[model samples]
Target: MPAILDDFPVLTPVTDEDLALAVQAVRVHAPEDWPHGTLCRSERVPYPCRLARWGGVTLAAAGLTDDQVSALVGTDA
Candidate 1:
């Protein structure tokens, strides 16, 4: 299992288009308050839904810090 983990979620080299798409995803999928719990604003799923997570990963791959990504998307989620 540990060995398999080493190769999981392969990350390709970040590209300008990838970074732009990631930022857009994060912006569109920002979290929203809910009675049950925080949820994804666009998809209405749990906070930090798959698209948000993907955006974060892509941003990180593009050498962006958490703060930078948050600022780029104008949200902390």
Candidate 2:
């Protein structure tokens, strides 16, 4: 089971573009060779990042609070 589980409200929902961009951003910016805290797992790089940014935006669009959205996936979104 995945330890990361956060419920995202259907308010804004996730668009195909958003998902795609998110994946790409994570892939490109966060190289596997980077250290654990080297922007891999942190809010230093604009939180969830482009993909994560979409998530936070969607959640916010759903009427969630900033903290709530950030807390949803149990990750810093």
Candidate 3:
């Protein structure tokens, strides 16, 4: 098994469009999440799954390690 994904869920990476949207999601929501209203995912995690999904994509775009990304913002799965 690839060591980077050893303990993570079996999820596909976020797409380019998803990543762009995720950047928007993070910009519009992070540090504060009211913009997303009740549907916002931050009610639980510090950076909700949706936001994290986008962040993951951004990290991937930047060519970071999966473990590094997970360690930084965690996975969407």
Candidate 4:
């Protein structure tokens, strides 16, 4: 069981294009202060919208920590 789990194949391999797009999504979807509460700056949905979450997950899967993601988010600003 352990071997099977360890050897499990990745269904979708991460590519440079994917990473770039994820980074863009993360940066563009950054949260903003709304009169009611936080929301996504790009799509204007709630903060940490689907695209942003997907980017964060992709970055994490690519070995970036939460701090790293936060730093990445701040890099453009």
Q: Give all TM-scores, in the order shown.
A: 0.80, 0.36, 0.32, 0.75
**Model 2: per-residue lDDT, tens digit, 9-69?**
3333666665444444444433122444344344455334444544545545546675664
- After superposition, the stretches of candidate 4 with alpha carbons farther than 4 Å from their true spots are 1-12, 75-77
Q: Would you list the clashing residue pairs of candidate 3?
A: none
How do the residues 9-61 of candidate 1 rate in per-residue lDDT, one tens digit apiece?
41679888888989998899988999999999999988888778888888898
Q: How accurate locally, in lDDT, is each candidate?
A: 0.83, 0.46, 0.50, 0.77
> Highest lDDT among the candidates is held by which one?
1
lDDT of 3: 0.50
Instruction: Give per-residue lDDT, candidate 1, residue 9.
Output: 47
**Model 1 misses residue 58 by how many Å?**
0.5
- lDDT string for model 3 (1-77, tens) is 57853333313465666555545554444443455443335434445455555554565765667676444443342
lDDT for 4 in candidate 3 is 56
Minimum summed lDDT over a 10-residue window in model 2 is located at 29-38
